[model samples]
Target: MAPVFAHGQLRLYLLSLLNEGPRHGYEIMRDLEQRFNGLYTPSAGTVYPRLAKLEEEGLVSRSDDGRKATYTITAAGRDEVARRQLDLGDLQSDLDRSASQLAEEVRSRVKGEAADLRAELKAAAREARRVARPAGEPMSGRAGSEFERQINELRSSARKLVRSRRTSEAVRAEALRIVREAQQRIDDLS
Candidate 1:
């Protein structure tokens, strides 16, 4: 994605920066990185297209000075900048909330499937043992080894499930913290 969306609400800052004075593309990118303390030092490639999109959206305009083209904000762009804090918070909140719910749903489904697989494995093992047993072929040793191997596989699968669940939880937690605390900080600044 372009820095416009990756930086999320920072695009408003670009509009705000333009409100101060007309600036070239590099200037806008530099100012944003400075303002955010390098949280997002946008690349020229990303910023230029984003600027073009903003211009296409009627949020900004440009002028040529025989060298670098300077960009300026329109009234619509100013309104957009003014509303940035609230809109950004809402977007983050919605996204994080959705992630949290989805993580929980995945965790529940995996747990249910694990239970079903355990039952099926036990039934299959039982049926196999009952139906086949060569006379004095020493099936007991083979069955014991197979049982151990299957149990190890189950254990390995459970560990992977645990790791996946924990990783998702960690991501959801970070998103929630950003949505809650970062929103408040931006609101205070605005």
Candidate 2:
């Protein structure tokens, strides 16, 4: 994947964020994460050092309220932001492109994984049917049909979830967990 921010771009971007309003370190991180649609989450190690650099440069001022420090942009910071308005716009465009690429990659991977799971489940179902049948007897009718229906429903649901742009990371993670557990149980059945 390409770097989300080019060299020195994040520093400027952080200043722009501060120019909007005063914020604590974690809030800045959260805001960045939200901006990227949960694609890029900056660690404290990444953000705090840059913040410290900005403070050292007198581009921002920090107020320590015992536990947490809130940072606000200085006059110089606003001047810098004003001076680099075009650059900031360009950076935002780059960020949007990067985020879109990342989202597409995630969607592709999820779709591929869902397809793999479907194939595995189908194979497992076949194995179970074969194992459950005697030499001359067919698979159990109603029970087998019901199991097939459940598998179809699972596949359909997984496909829909994977394809939905509105699906959140948390929801995607939980769905993956449930699918993996179901695959494990089905494997055990065979």
Candidate 3:
């Protein structure tokens, strides 16, 4: 994967953030994570050094309330932000594009995984049907149809869930739990 921020871009972006208002290190990291749509999370090693450098350059001033240090943009920081308005705009555009691409890739991967799961479930169901049936006897028509219908319903629901943009981690966890439970029940049959 490519670096999220180009050389010197993070420093400039951090300054731009401070230009908005005073912020602590954790808040800056959280803001970056949010701006990147959870695609990028900055470590303290990445952010704090840049902040210290900015303070050393007199671009930002810091105040400590004994617990944490809050950084406020200095006149120089605001001036720099004002001077690089065009760069900031470009950075914002780049971030938006990257986030969108990453999200699409995630969605595509999830769809593929869901399809794989469906295939595995179908195969397992077929094996189970074969094993449970007596030799020279066919499955009951109504029972087989109902079982296939339920499998199809599961596949359809999984596909829909994978495609939904608003699907949250909790929803995904519940879906996973259901899949696991179904797999466990299938194992119990064998």
Cα-based TM-score, every candidate: 0.40, 0.72, 0.69
* Predicted structure 3: clash tally: 0
Ordered by TM-score, highest first, the candidates read: 2, 3, 1
Kindly report which residue stretches of model 1 are placed more than 4 angstroms away from their true locations once superposed.
1-8, 38-40, 88-190
User: Model 2, 123: alpha-carbon shift in Å?
Assistant: 1.2
How would you order the candidates by lDDT, starting with the best?
Answer: 2, 3, 1
Error of 2 at 172 (Å): 4.9
Q: State the C-alpha lDDT per candidate.
A: 0.62, 0.81, 0.80
Q: Model 3, which residues run further than 4 Å from truth?
A: 133-190
lDDT of 3 at 156: 81
Alpha carbon RMSD to native, model 3:
8.3
Tell me model 3's lDDT, rounded to 2 decimals: 0.80
Q: Which candidate is the best by TM-score?
A: 2
Taking the tens digit of each residue's C-alpha lDDT, what string does model 3 give over 35-54? Answer: 98886789999999999999
Model 3, residue 36: distance off in Å is 1.9
Candidate 1, TM-score vs. the true structure? 0.40
